[model samples]
Target: MEAAMSTPGRGLTWSLRGRGPADVPVVADPGPWPPDSGGPAATGRGVRVCVVDSGVERDHPAVGRVDGSWVVVKDPDTGETSVRPTETGDSCGHGTACAGIVRRTAPECELHSVRVLGERFSGTGDVLLAGLRWAVEQGFDLVNLSLSTTRDRFARELHELADQAYFARTVIVASAHNTPVESFPWRFASVISVGSHQEDDPGLHLYNPSPPVEFFAPGQNVPVPWLGGATIRTTGNSFATPYITGLCARLLSAHPSMTAFQLKNALYLSAANVRFRSLPSLPAGEASDESSESDEPGELHRSRESPEPPEPRLAAGADGTGN
Candidate 1:
């Protein structure tokens, strides 16, 4: 069932290349918010994570204990997409790789998979939409979208879906296009878009004071699970996305009630780049938009003291459009 596939972009660069770590201000106080990514005890035990990709292998050593699996099928004559349970495992090893990363980061989180791509990552935009819609409807704590469509025709619908999920409190962690290009879902403000850093530390994540891409994680030449119970090292914005997703899972484990807005705020506060001063009070636990429908109650600001090199910009969502 392989078809022409959307290519995963490679080499997303968001780094302050020349500056040493000491130069950048490190603020340990991530506001008065509940513990987030750096929470030492949170292992994502109660979180339910959905990996919407080419499907995940059930018993792969690197990706142990998958909770569930599904595949999106399209009827040839009707051209409609639908979900069905499957035990066949990964079609292109992409989903397994992503699941493995999530497992490594959030070992206790229940991992689920929804296959939306075929071998070589071949898939259609409609299927991507269908799989994502189902994943969102399930109300999973976090959904990882490591794949995206570059087509402008799908943008509006995808944006709507992303927003819908945002309001539903189904936090979506999407990958930025590996290259500098227009991509859906990631560009929207509703989803937490991620890019890659070359750092070997899987636990190290950075906040992009600048975005379409909001966060950066380990993605370059990352060692991940492949097909046939083997291990392979690969790199792409896709890999980086799951790392952020896992972090989101950990955050949710600790808070258990944080909304998408507060989750994102937590991320911004925990970001290694930001100089955390006493942050303004945020809504303790507002579920949805309030009196006015907008991104947030007020703008979230980051303080950058002088003499520090500018934050590096690479990875998904670095479109610079601020959309």
Candidate 2:
């Protein structure tokens, strides 16, 4: 299923327009901690990764190895949601692709599948919320949310759930909508928001200085697993999310004590776009003027003294108030 479904407000910008490498400023290096120190031997041996998407085919060759699986069943009459253990297959192959990507990245990480979306690649916000809440409660080390809710009514509830996962040390890696439409869970700063980059290397990803999206990974024309034990080349932010999820599995497996915040910091430091050397600065007068109005659109204008830009502030927590 295409990640960018034709939903309202889907035409928003998802790409950085008219920007080049030279436009990015070089900043001094911050020494790296929570090192991405493990290899395949440390491939998430003790870490757990949960894919909160459509569903993962437990036996597909690409996703041939999964540790466990769960499906969410909702009662239409009563509007109640419950989880039941099942060895189900992918509903639309999207979840299988995500699972395969994560497995490829973190070969040894224990994998769990949660079915929220159905064959049409859609689900209700209530169901999504219920699945997310359960995942947080389970305390999985890393929860991947490739789907998001656009309804404003669920924003507060989803925000609370994201924060709950945040404080519980369950890092939520969510995908930004393929279109620029406003979406929940991913927009919340408590979760690590990811988007697609036009790159082919699965291991490569970049850090976004901009808000709403914090990371970009290979999501275009990528080969991913499909239903029926086959593979196809597809593209979407959905596929890109699992790449980071896999990397997180490796990091968490190596540094068991690292919190979600620390894991994010390590990712920023290790990103390919991160600069270790400081760039030449303009005169103080020129700097002040540049900040007021920039000739280049979308050029990030921050003080050069700081090694990195500040992270986006957390949105209002469960109570509809800022943290």
The best candidate by lDDT is: 1
Per-residue lDDT of candidate 2, residues 206-300 (tens digit): 89998789999899998998988899999889988988888788766655666788778767866667655323366676544434444345544
- The top-ranked prediction according to TM-score is 2
Q: What local distance difference test score does each model get?
A: 0.77, 0.76
Which 10-residue window in model 2 sums to the lowest lDDT?
314-323
TM-score of every prediction relative to native: 0.73, 0.74
Per-residue lDDT, model 2, residue 97, is 92
Model 1, residue 13: distance off in Å is 42
lDDT of 1 by residue, 1-323 (tens): 01112332333225667778886774432322222434334567889999999889778999999999999888877987789988879888999999999888777899999999883334458889889999999999999999889888888888888888997889999999998988878999999999998888766678887787989988999999999999999999899998888877776665566788777866664556655333445578855444333334444345554312132211111111011
Error of 2 at 182 (Å): 0.5
lDDT, model 2, position 200: 67
